[model samples]
Target: MSINLSEPIKIVFNEIEIDDYLPSIKFKIDINIKQFTHLLTYSGEIWIDCKVWDRFSKGLNEGKDTTLNDMDDIFIIEIIKNNEFIEFTWSIKRKDPEGNVMTAGYSSKITDDVYSVIRNEFINYPKWW
Candidate 1:
């Protein structure tokens, strides 16, 4: 039997809403991962302070590992550089109707180009308030 490696993680920024009373932006995030012929997807809405994005970018530029999460802890993304590859991890947490917390996540290692992909996405993200 042969082992299969997962595809590079994909992140898409959907609709965005800037809070009028706060320095935060609320937006929808869509994450997709494909392994062989199987596709896994997760989408959720999260609010994040405007400054966090800037800080995240700076950290990446400095070659430091970084982790970003929504204000509510509902979604989280962690990126770490390992030699010539980047380790990407994402997780989602939610509560069932019975109030029990459920969590799911996935991690993969992809080419260092992932850093450029993320930077481009953030730079071109919707900015209308």
Candidate 2:
């Protein structure tokens, strides 16, 4: 789907906030779109698994983790299209201790071009952002 890959774009992981001990980790991601876009406004949130969260928190407290790159978190993106909010989601999965996969997996409705742009933004971060 021919996205303008050359257009300048920026994606930054701003801050992490935890709401509860059911322990949802709230993150703010900003995508600076300086080029083509059909979206009016964009926002996103991701939830990390408890195990991953423990690891993340431990690393944070220990002041060692550089980035959230090694996480298998669920990512959710929302866009204002046609004056309405449309939600999209993507996730990573892995086998459990019992050799069974566990997750309330998700799906997304965003187009290939949009997904490509978003993925590219993160894939290039920490090195080129």
Q: Number of the top candidate by lDDT?
A: 1
lDDT of each: 0.69, 0.39
List model 2 lDDT by residue over 25-110, tens digit each: 44565444443444322345454444454443344344332224223443422222232332343233446678887333233344
Best by TM-score: 1
RMSD value for candidate 2: 14.6
Clashing pairs in 1: none
Predictions: Cα RMSD each = 6.7, 14.6
The clash tally of candidate 2 reads 1
TM-score, per-candidate, Cα-based: 0.77, 0.27
List candidate 1 stretches off by more than 4 Å: 1-7, 123-129
